[model samples]
Target: MDGSLKEEQILMSSERDWTDLPPNLIHLISQKLPDLRYFIRCGAVCKRWFSSILLSDPPPQQLPWLIEYDEQFPRASPLKEELPFYSFVTGETGSIPIQESHRGKVYHRTGHSYLLVIDGEVISLFNPLTNEEISLPQLPSRFDFIWPVFGGADPSRNWPWHISLVCDVGRSRYLTYYLDRMRWQCFDTVLHKTCNWDGMLFTTEDHGTSTLVFDAASRKELYTIPPLNEETFGFITSYFVESCGELLRVSLDYNLTRNIETYIFLIYKLNFEGGKGQPHWVKVSNIRDQIIFLDHLTGFAVRATAGLKGNCIYFFIEEHCRSDRFYNDSTLWRYDIATGTCEPVPCPFNRCSWFVPNLR
Candidate 1:
């Protein structure tokens, strides 16, 4: 082969136009992009790619991303720069720049695909990718924490949100206000957790030992978690995940260490298939092909696909996972549900939660 021919081949490859690809093929390429930043970059390549990205607003099988807290990594300025988000599929990191007035706001809580952020006295549901926010129902000016329940947000019409607000004042009532409802509904219950599967609020008279579902929309008790004898499991934290239309209670009894490598997890499934309110805790040894990701506070389950590992629980280790000791919580891990083993998942960012980016 001639040297000139080889040189021309290199130049031809370098100058190839990606826009020449078919629109249907471009659309297929856009469908697999998990990060909004990737879509933006692909769209910037050419007009055809831009139109392709715009048309693929809600991608098929949107995987959750791990968005690190702005403070978790070194930045020019926490308020000046964008927050980095890592995608599990692409193995790439993208930044979500703080737009307009949301620069100073602090992150409060993470929902399915949204975040509850507090901007002084006003609390808002913020979607970082699209820069869309909806003001939540006003509190009594002295609220402790608010959990945003993710429902119809983006690529769809605005639907009601079942948001839980825990007030730490005079009466100390656990209240939840539905966006569809006009008034805030108060519950006498203490421990509060929102079941992300069906937007059902799980609360109990006891402090997290037993769980019950409280529906603020109708002001009714939908179901009750039978008294789980804490004396038996003796777990410091009872992490609950609703998967496949079943309520699962994962009991972890471990003394966490920086050097330690494994953990013992007792998995329990609520036997409510027979009927509602008649469920009992059944010990399950196998988690099969389902993958669980614990996004800081709540655990999210997804079917293992692509090259992703399954039969494992991806847990965010808040404190020791970061490179800097000063940074409080910023680490991710994959816990094998079968072997009760865990390993740190290497990523460039931290303080991760389940995030589905929506441009629509």
Candidate 2:
């Protein structure tokens, strides 16, 4: 009789309506969600739950979503109609719809949550998470290839957002756009890689032998930091990322010969107040409580939460092997900064970009 009574109570509780829960309790539960996807799903349970989630604070740290371009899609289909985002935490894929005006456009690059898309001569910034689109003025002439670098936003400046468009012809040229001004300015210098830090734009040339700093507000070159004379035998790629109120540069050296490939990673932090009041690179072995996400083009850093790992780099490697013919293989890898070790992580897409989703 006691067992039967307990069973009946359990059945009644299982059938209870979850929507009747107190809003404060629901908000607390929403705050405990592991990631953004779960938080979004929790809001979909009911209208009351959605209201509670809106009042709750999201997770402080978030892992970036991998946005991939589907090669299997029909060539005539609009590429920007929908984007597939893969989550590392859940190991699941989800689709986010693009705005109707952004359809049929091609994206040149991605920075954080924003996509730099081009339609004919017009360029626009689209945020898939928020469904916000801002169109820029048309370019003077359309280029065959465009490599765009986002300088983020500075509310203190006259123009808040800064974008640099590098036209790849025989020689590289830069075209900068100011958001508030709604105009473009052409620069004659050639830049290899660019990143934004503390309201300034940093550019590298000649394989990062030197770094040029440009004031995003004034549109003038501030100063240049001398190169670090490091010798290695393979192709070197450098990435600049800001983390923990400081700027860092991560360099990857790799050699592909025959069927074997070797990779080495080195990290350096920029010290603004060094000896004699000049900025210089300081070699760093560990970056505590921070995670870095990198691709071939750009990279960014984020704080690590309980669900994420810190002092490591999450990047992908595209391998080409020539056995009978030529074939390509892509794999995601995690490199530990302290141990100098690398391990492979499973990824569904061969080519993807790291997108940090934001509700704002």
Candidate 3:
């Protein structure tokens, strides 16, 4: 019972193996993890911990990470193949290496952890998290722009993939590709700023004046919601994001006068209580516990967790050239729906997409 005995006991406890912890205890610990980053780290402790963590439910939705990439990288040589990712939860930067086979390709777009890339006659969807690559057949060279819409299942599940591509070249057209079919079928429709909600695609046409609902699987036009009669004094751009099992339209209104630019945001939710045929738009002052992430092409909603703010919209601002002078640098900004205020969020990357990290 002297000093030597006490020291010996402490040393033994310190050397104990963490893998010996019971699976149930490990599951309990994983449930208390604040974010997916910590959950993933906990799993890396040992094989037993990884197995247990996989059995337990994943941690709550974490803040989306900003994925940074250079679109203008020289394609003549295979250089700068790694893409950097910045996490708001941890305030740290991490990167993943792009495969050499996928190098020298044009990065078309990104959504939900997947990158759409074009290489000559091949179009591929690459997920940096899982290192999974899906190659689609090349489309006619006439269409220039492509936007992916994940349908049928959540973005977290990558299997049984159902993707709809919005191909645009002055006129817009829709195309659907299913894993089962392994082919892309074109749907001639003029849809803009589309979002998927509950297996349906909601889109706006005619400059946000009308909302069109389409059955994603059937490729049939269901109905349309009459436009909101609100008036504003500036140029307006609309985006659709699904929130809390409902469709919400976010309008970004901006005006440039005398070399000064100002922005205003307006939110409206699609109300269906009146009836599906008579659905109406209702102005929403608050988003409750949700946060919206938007880039230039698409936007999505995620529930707020600890260390995150709800009722806010985080979006990217691109650099613009005014009067032969570069005025602003590309950056990220947060707009608070409750306060009706906008502020810049610190980001080191210029061109980025919102990516929610997941193991699957």
Candidate 4:
């Protein structure tokens, strides 16, 4: 062939019709792509390419796969930085910025799309997707409101559209609030006697406890956990991780022996659908090395960091001394249950009381 003709053939080959490729070959290109944008670019090459990529089996496993440690890995000087938030998919850090700090502050994360925030007496439901927030009725602070815990039906399930909060005051009083209903109801449970301000409202897929919602107008604990016999208490703390479709509760007992204090970590699976509570809890970790639960991390023990894929629980381990609270330098570590390993991830902030993963 002529030299000019040969050069033209090479150019045509570079622009070969993407439709000529098989579906599997197109899928390989999508998976092998390093980032989401690149995968998207591949789909834009041609109509057939886009259709094949989208229709390919196993769909694109685009849910955040890798944990992106912000400039803040091996987070040291805990108090110096606020909790770090990031997007696992974009490898972005501190994605959500709090322009105006509210009075009640954010309690628990509902999903990657929404967060439950308390402002004064009212509850603010913030949606990251719409970038808009709605205000709910003021909660009875005296009753001691429960944190909002959320989960979906499954990976194929719809995004969570509602939330529940269970409030308890003193003893023999309980209340439950459902966000969808925008109302409060009263129920009685065996736990009425065992319930305390520190006693948390538990939920899971099977036999889980419902959130106690408080009525500011009634000024009473109205909701109660049924079949309370299934409910057990020792040291209870709950948190939801968006990266993994699961809610985690760390229960432990701390007792002092011979002037030494010890801590144990027990994990519980939350049953959100069946409203059934699990009788047995799973033990995750235990540190007997003269460690005391710092008063700061008493209620909310575990937090999920943003920008990571998979089930990794970020715990703020406080080093306490008999003289006073362990403030100076705190260590943040990631406990990866899948790998059964705990390693320190770096953070860029200081004096971080809690970690809010960036939801971008």
User: TM-score for each prediction?
Assistant: 0.76, 0.83, 0.79, 0.43
Query: Lowest lDDT 10-mer window, candidate 3?
Result: 318-327
Query: Which candidate gets the maximum TM-score versus the true structure?
Result: 2
* CA shift of 201, model 2, Å: 3.0
lDDT (tens digit, per residue) of candidate 3 on 99-171: 7776666665665767777777877777766678877777755345666665421475655465666666563
- Residues 296-319, model 2: lDDT tens digits: 556777777647779999987744
Model 4 lDDT on a 0 to 1 scale: 0.40
Candidate 1 vs 4: which has more lDDT = 1
Which wins on lDDT, candidate 3 or candidate 4?
Answer: 3
Lowest-scoring 10 consecutive residues by lDDT in candidate 4? 288-297
The global C-alpha lDDT for each of the candidates, from Candidate 1 onward, is 0.60, 0.69, 0.69, 0.40
- Once fitted onto the true fold, the runs of candidate 4 whose alpha carbons sit more than 4 angstroms away are 1-84, 87-94, 97-112, 117-122, 138-146, 151-162, 166-180, 185-249, 252-264, 268-312, 318-331, 336-341, 351-360
RMSD values for the candidates in order, in angstroms, are 5.1, 4.0, 4.4, 10.9
Give the per-residue lDDT of model 1 (tens digit) for 161-216.
43444433335445544444645566544454444335456654322366676554
Q: 49-166 in candidate 4: lDDT tens per residue? A: 8898678643232332222223332221111123334333354554333434432253442422345555446666664323467676676453443434333322222423334455
Q: Residue pairs in steric clash, candidate 1?
A: 318-329
As a TM-score, model 3 comes out at 0.79
Candidate No. with top lDDT: 2
Better of 1 and 3 by TM-score: 3
